[model samples]
Target: MTTNTQNLSGQSILAGAATTGNGRAVHGYNPATNEPLEPAYSLIDLDQLKIATAAAAEAFESFRSLEPAKHADFLDAIAENIEAVGAELAARAMAETGLPEARLTGERGRTTGQLRLFAKVIRQGDQHGVRVDPALPDRAPLPRVDIRQRKIAVGPVAVFGASNFPLAFSTAGGDTASALAAGCPVIFKAHNAHPGTSEIVGRAISKAVADFGLHPGVFSLVYGPGATIGQALVADPVIKAVGFTGSRSGGTALMATAAARPEPIPVYAEMSSINPVIFFAGALSEDPAAQAKAYLGSVSGSSGQLCTAPGLVFVPTGAGGDAFAQAISSQAPNTAGQTMLTEGIYNSWIQGVEALGGQPGVELLGRGTEGAGQNAPAPAIYSSSVEQLLENPVLQDEIFGAASLVIRYDSAAELVTALSKLEGQLTATLQLTDADHETAAAVLPTLETKVGRILVNGWPTGVEVGHAMVHGGPFPATSDPQTTSVGTLAIERFLRPVAYQNFPNALLPRPIAKDNPWNLTRRIDGTLTTTGE
Candidate 1:
């Protein structure tokens, strides 16, 4: 099959327009066909980094002072612009990342949905988090001074895009959406795998900025080597915080860079996770076929590229467990080999499978149908005892592909011991029945300590973008578990609170002003209300 890669003018979008960056040239390739796409993108080196970040810093002055409703309009405009270019964005993303058209299309929707969600968040005024205290000048011993507090944008943000979920995690993705919603300008570093898609989305965001008559520096997208370009961005004094979604090593490196800066900055990175699924006795003993189908579907979706994929499953030992294992082995082989996002990911997955198969007390149960592509690999299932998993620490690392391990446990104590050994995860699932409530209750506390989102009798493949969704977890799952990268709260990562003491009403922030210009919800004299006493 012949396909035409877009003749994208590979250039960095610096402060709202395309520029041939002053750095070495980098080119993107079509992973499906192993063909290099047209036009070479100029890597943003140390010099271009200064220009982009400086623009963001300059823009933050005005951007942060804009009214909350104006910020909402800017965010809504970005969403509209993204929808305008949705078809082209999906097409470019599929050609570069080897993802199917439908998946890319849905991701485009998710990206725009996140933008609109944040727009609503800004308009609601909760993010401002205002509190005010009236002065008690008539006090006998000492007169109390008036005090006010509110949240404000940290400053310019540097966002590193992810290889998977190009539209939802790259360019104008969650990180950019949240930072912009917080009133911080963005200095985005596009992933090398999909520069064309980045360019297209970057252009759309730039157009939105102009349409709203905002500063051109409100958004910028650059591309280059991870070590150089990424490091430079994080180290820039103008960049107050960072947002990243990538491998553990990659995320850690950016974290180190931010820490080494003269004034250390926060790096909100979504790194690695081996989301585990535990099947209680009742769940394992009943409806084997349906459970098997759901398990396979979660593990094989997007070739298991999702961070929330069920990488490990625990089941009880004996006849019921054997039936579950048999069902898994039978259903797994039916899923055909899928084209991975990159050649490196495919090779790493093969090594992971080989390591698991060669480990002590591990058995290869099934292998799916293979496809004819350089970056395509078949899904595989392996089995081992809970004791073996406890013995081998290497088994806990993520493989980044379509694969999973089924561990059989002899007793409830053994299941707890095995789960205790797991590293921090994005999610954990409990396949339960009404009869298993006692067991579920016992494990709920442990699951809370090890994972961010706990699922009940459902797969963790789809993450909804909303007010309450937490797409982050402790440590390896993310740099900070307190913040989410996909919800309204994500804006908090780029915001910091400040208190105003003894300031006159005219000098106070609008949200905290005496007259309540914005009519925001705030605490006044220990009472929550829009009107001050």
Candidate 2:
């Protein structure tokens, strides 16, 4: 439970075994100081990587059929092991990613809480998705044969760690938790920016696997070049599905590799999104200065490295809008930037901001003071017209930092037209009151198709992890809009339905068997029924 740099192997944990690779070694760097941390991690070759995938395939047979109690227990144990790491985990993550200790501590709790949530989901057994259609021996035209169905694990899954969230969206994050809950073996590709943090959490999961007496292949943590090993992992025939959280370019590249395989597989990749916020006249009439502060806080928080950060704001051109803009101009100059995840990310953010600022109609609204750190850059907000935003594609691209664009619109019709031109987004917000209901209703349909989640009178920076919450959207927001990367529904991404026709009770899966051994809720003849119902 007590982990430190001295005990860190900086090696790939393959099938519960510590492995050292001969390929190039990489070190985790402290972004706040721009210095490398101790214990360089060795990169694994493609052949070495195969060992993990092959073991995962071998483990799937037994793992996919685990008893509900044991399966739920395994997930619960993982949560406990991660929680036991405690302060050590937070300290290591802070050193690697330049995130504050308080933030990392809360993220670690969120990570464990989600694992435990999945444990509850496993015990309930509803995810089995069982259904039965009784045979009809006598019918006017013909007899109907017996048919039954239930969802099953797809197979081994490849998960890529995220850069922004070292704990909540990395190692044992939502993607890995949901895949494991669906009974799929996982081969996790650690993010190079936070190798040490990955190692600490990877060991926790490995310990849980050992404690449960499950196949060591149930989980494996790997390190390597993203271009070489990352794409190769998706291309591996043994891997049946993939879970990714990163850039649009990275997600599209993996989608291509997955499609090219002899047996194509699904890649549930969370990619780019510039979450937009719209301000109606009435909502801005009440204390525009306070509203502006709240808006800027969401934009600049976590250095705007969040996937759900509000990158675009729509304000009407009038007195209320003028008041809001004046408040932003007054407060934005004082906002400070925090250290970013990596040097490459910092450099890319700078380039994006410069390119956006150079656009034909874009003008700098305000700039904040730079924070005291190696990679910290000043936060910036730009302004543009609806006409320019609709005409120029560059104005819509996500800067991926503490930068946002404020677009001025002349009328409701113009606002809707400008919104229609936007790409798919993870979220959209409306600042409205009773007077704005008509305007809000007019735009609801378009927003339904454009975003996964809609917020009213609130910013989109915080995402709730629960059964009903969706962290995905159409097209560019994620590779598969039907699936979410967070919440219980995410388990479906790694599962597929299989039908059994005219099969004897003895040969049927437990969930759909005649005896009803698993005690699952099932749909029979289009009616929801449980045991004794």
Candidate 3:
């Protein structure tokens, strides 16, 4: 445990084997010490891309035909393999990302939990969306023909590893789990910031594929700079869909690339969000100190690197509001600074703070404890007027660090106006009391239009992985608001409906056959049941 015992092949994985490509070289880094880790990773070459994607296309034919139980077993095997890595995985991730062992351990659990949840979802047999309409020869005019419909996999997908949550959002993460559950193979691109961590997780997935005796092409992990292999994977004709989590520019660029292809595909990219939190007068007056403490904690956690961090907080302007601001100013300085995940991110956070502080009418309330590490960033709190935020669109952009912008408003109407000026967000939280029902009701519509999830007297930092969770939003928050990047529902994004007309029972998919071999719930002649009759 003292030495880094994690296996670092530093090679891209293709068709279940560790490989070295003929592209640019990349190395992982220890953000805490600003030192590079061992085992360099080579980018997947154009020839390798063709090989990996072709294998994926070849594997799809059999993978899509595998029974739901087999798919569930495969997913479960993957989770078990990941858990087998244990502390080695946590240690490597902590060193690479500068995240605490506890944080990485929790993220590891979330990753495995998501895979297991998708296993249960596939076992339920409802993802197929079976519908059958029997022919009615007794009808007047021409006889109606029998028709059936069911969902099918959308072919292979390209998944880009995220920089923040190396384990939960990278190789073998939610996108990969959901895609594999929907019967599509995945080609993962390792993030440069955490290549060592990606390699370890990728090895687990490769081992699971071998253990389950599934096709080797069912999963592959590629490495390189984001611009090189990333574009090649998306443009590969074999890849039918994409899953990404990164900056707005990066997401939009990928979307544009996918759109320009001869056969365009869906790109579910979670880009950016300045998840806003609104504070009601009653909640603040009830316990200002408690509210202030909670706010500081949420914004400062993980160096404020989370996508759902409360970047913007709305408060009422008055003596009570002044007291709340003063309380935050007093506590923020005491919150210790933490090392960021990457040097580039730390630089960006510094520049962002400068921009906000230099803006007209924006006042810096306080700064947190500073650290000596080159990649460390101190927490900061700032206050501004509603008019200033409305006039400066830049204020709405996320800082991607431990900083929160407080906008004080004189009236509820002003709060609504400020809300209207904001863009789409991943979440919107409202701190309200039972007596503030009317005001809560008034702001609900604005919140609904602006965010994917609405919170009642809750913080937006921690996202639950379940059946009802939505880790996505409109436009800037994600490319497609209709879909989410978390939970069992994410499987639907990689599936498409297919219908059969007048096909023989033997020719139809088992789930949609008139004989009902699979015993799945289906709409038969407009009635929902397990039996076709």
Q: Please name the candidate that would achieve the greatest lDDT relative to the true structure.
A: 2
Error of 2 at 504 (Å): 1.0
lDDT of 1 at 355: 85
lDDT of 3 at 324: 89
Please write out the lDDT profile of model 2 over residues 1-533, one tens digit for every residue: 23344478989989889899779999999999989998899999999999999999999999999999999999888888888778788888999998998888888888998998998888888778888888888965999888998899999999999999999889999999999999999999999999989999999899888888889999999999989999999999999999999999999999999999999999999999999999999988889999899988999899999999999999999999999998999999889989999989999999999999999999998788888888899999999999999889998898898999999998889999998999999999999999999999998988999999999999999888899999999989999888889899999899999999999887888889877877778898788887521
Q: Which stretches of candidate 2 lie over 4 Å from their true place?
A: 1-6
True lDDT of residue 171, candidate 2: 93
How many residue pairs in model 3 have overlapping backbones?
0
Task: List residue ranges in candidate 1 displaced over 4 A.
Answer: 1-7, 138-143
TM-scores of the candidates in the order shown: 0.96, 0.98, 0.97
**lDDT for each residue of candidate 1 in 7-40, tens digit (9 for 90 to 100):** 5678887887678878788778888778888678
List pairs with backbone clashes in candidate 3. Answer: none
Give the local distance difference test score of model 1: 0.86
* lDDT, candidates in the order shown: 0.86, 0.91, 0.88
